[model samples]
Target: MKRRKVPLRMCISCKEMKPKKELLRIVKNSEGKINIDLNGKLPGRGAYICHNPQCLEKAIKHKLFERIFQQKVDKEIYVRLTDILTENDEDI
Candidate 1:
């Protein structure tokens, strides 16, 4: 039997390529809704980020979401991302 290949995605913060399952996804939907995508199956444009809080901060500090999505990110979205990060940390 042959093993399947794993998909990879690049983190917008640290810019490292990692397995897709390990990265958190953020999506901009067609209706202009932006949110954290835990399932990684949402439609529209998507960007990847590491679960690490530092990477989240760097992305926020540099306005990376704006650059990639070409729209302003809501403060609430950042808050939600931070909350998710904390939850992820607690799991470890």
Candidate 2:
């Protein structure tokens, strides 16, 4: 069997390259709305972050999303992301 290549993405907070599925994706759609792309199939500009809360905080503190999206990220988006993370953490 041929060896398969794994898709990799860099975490904006940690600056670490990791398998795409291991990170969470955030996307900005055509309407300029930002959302967490849980399925990773949303059509839009995407940025990745690690599953850890520390990475999420670093990204927020440094305004990584604003830089990546080229616009201000609404507070609701951050709230939503944090909610999602906490929910996932509880399940683990």
Q: Residue by residue across 1-92, what tens digits does model 1's lDDT show? A: 99998999999999999999889999999999898899988998999999889999999999999899999999999999999997898898
Q: How many steric overlaps are in each model, in order?
A: 0, 0
TM-score of each: 0.94, 0.91
Q: Give the TM-score of candidate 1.
A: 0.94
Error of 1 at 51 (Å): 0.7
- With candidate 2 superimposed using the best TM-score fit, by how many Å does residue 20's alpha carbon deviate from the native? 1.0
Candidates in order have lDDT scores of 0.94, 0.91
Tens digits of per-residue lDDT for model 2, 16-56: 99999889999999999888999999999999998877788
Candidate with top TM-score is: 1
Structure candidate 1, residue pairs in collision: none
Using lDDT as the measure, which candidate wins?
1
Provide C-alpha RMSD values for all models, in order. 1.0, 1.2
